[model samples]
Target: MNTDTIVAVATPAGKGGVAVVRLSGSEALAVAMGHLTASRLQPRKATFCRFTDTAGQLVDEVLATWFPAPHSYTGEEMVEISCHGSPYVQQEVVAELIASGARLAEPGEFTLRAFANGKLDLSQAEAVADLIDSATPAQHRLAVSQLRGGYANELKRLRQQLLDLTSLLELELDFSQEDVEFADRCTMLDTVAQLQSRVQSLLGSFSTGNALKQGVPVAILGRANAGKSTLLNALLGDDRAIVSPIAGTTRDTIEETMTIDGITFRFIDTAGLSQSDDELEALGFARSIKAAQQATILLFVRSVTIPFNAYATDDIAYFTDQCDMSSKHLFIVHNKCDLPHESNPPGHIVSAKEGLGIDSLKASMVAAMRKDASANDGVLLTNLRHRSALQRVQEALLHVAEGLGQQMPTDLVAVDLRDAIYHLGTITGDVTNDELLGNIFSRFCVGK
Candidate 1:
């Protein structure tokens, strides 16, 4: 436990209506009181007071609130000073507190203390950072869910089951000399199978969770002069991409992001796919193919003004051969609907220049994502560290299942079981180390 008091400016640096400087630790109150006009403070009450330096000169008039130990954010005695938002006022007040014996806080020290004091688990502590950094509603909801213990509760249940099985297996090992079995091998195998299934399900959610956390990648692909860049500008409600009549105007990918119905989509407008004699144009085509391969969704744009038989329909054949579409959501979009066409294909028809049918296209994209999200359970695994730990748990469970199936010695099976438990424990901080904690908390902003 940290005994020395730590202080920091909690609010973002700049002028606002007010600024908050936070202090936490055993000596927080004493350090704060030393620089205030009031001799004592009422716990949890905001008292207007005059802040002064050690030389007894007034620095600022402030509203100070005190939170007693074990009930505050860090479960330690805490003091919050609400001062004028002037940069000089904020800096002077902090300097006064430091002169009175409070040290400057490191990044994430406040939340670190909260975790150290048992106010939050390891996963929830990470969620605090996520919630702070979330830009979209989907990301915010995922972070809030994890912070509320919805995800942690699920892991606790799994860890409890593993503990129960491990205890039984260890007991059986102890009774081996007597040639007696305490745990039925068949029952143990069944439990291990169930655990593996749950672990695998969590692992499966990582892709969707990560996509939601980081915007989903959507690649807009088509032949040259197909209005792919025009469609990109229309979807973004801005002229983000260059609109040119010349073919191959976009020699590389132009990326932009937009939030539709709370989900963020990263739209990549790639160079039009075509066999170009120019080396630069060919390099752009290569990048386009790479973008298509990585995209979760692909929009194949076609110009209605262009004849279907033009280029002998070789571009479509080339795209089909170059990209794997089996796992991706494919949308055929016919651009330039305002122009005359011989036939209307069976797909979305739109005029990118006039912003026609853009809303419908956005709706379709959202619908596809909703369908994908509906396939998973409510719990999502967004953190890469959690995903890695769960993956190890799955691997260990697999080994346990294999050993049990092969009728391996009880001691060997128990070893695998322990490995799975240890990995699972790492997620919720049932097992943790100094290095892991440092890596996690250091990412947080100071005074959080």
Candidate 2:
């Protein structure tokens, strides 16, 4: 446990109903009580008192709550002072606490202390930051599930299973001269295969999990004068992109974000895909192709004025070939539906200029996002770091299974099993380093 006390204003830096200054560590209570006029401070009870400086000048009429060691946020004595939301009052209270021997906390240092004191594991600690930053209902659900030991609990169970098997293999090594097998070869292979299957399942969820955690990328693709920019503006409900009847008016891609049914969709309106001799337009056209390739969802916008056969245009065909269209969720959208054209177009019809069919298009996008979403009742692996570690675990498990099949030495098999266990432990902080902790916690807000 840390010996020195730390203090910081735990609320946002602005005027509000109230602001909180928190203190933790051995001297937290002492520093907090030094400024309070009340003679008795009860644990877990909020005491209303007047806060004052060392010179007996009143600062604010605040409520202070005390928490004794081992039952508080940082597993140490803690105090929280709630005062009127004034920046001056907050600063003065902090200054008074510092004068009484509390130092300001560093970014994420409070949560780091909590982790160090065994209040939370590494995964749960990361979840603390996620819960704070969650912008939507889905994100909040995921963070809460993780904080409740979602993937961390599952990984712990898996690691324990591997550890048990490895111990059996180790025992066989000790009695190698007798040629006795402590672990059944068939049973060990079966266990490894099961572990591998679970790891792969989690690895597959990375795509959906990451997209939900961050924002989904949707790329708008079509030729010039296809109302691509108009469609973008309509989807955003604002004049985000310039619309012009002139061909190739959009020389570059315009990116904007909008929330659809609690999911953030980043829409990128790219330049039209046509053979252009102009240098900058050519560069933008190349960028458009790149965006189409990278987008999670592709909106192949087309105008009704353009014949339905335009779907087979050389540029469209080239783009389809360049991007493995099968990998991404592709949606064909016919814009300018109000105008006269062919009897049938190969997609959802919409008039971006008239705001028709926009709601249906949004619904389709949300459906695409939820197509593979199973009941997400437990923790999903949203962090790339967690996915990478699970991938390594999967590889190590595969090695163990293969070694067991080939009747490799028990000690060699044990090495692979241990490697798999170590990788699993990394997710739950059973095996971690200072650098990884620093990188994870640095993204947190200063007061957290």
Assess each prediction's global lDDT (C-alpha) against the native. 0.89, 0.86
Model 1 regions more than 4 Å off? 305-327, 342-346
C-alpha RMSD of each candidate structure in angstroms: 2.5, 2.3
Q: How many angstroms is residue 411 displaced in model 1 relative to the true structure, after the best TM-score fit?
A: 1.7
User: Worst lDDT window (10 residues) for model 2?
Assistant: 370-379
Total clashing residue pairs per candidate? 0, 0
Model 1: residue 394 alpha-carbon error in angstroms: 1.7
Using lDDT as the measure, which candidate wins? 1
- Pairs in clash, predicted candidate 1: none
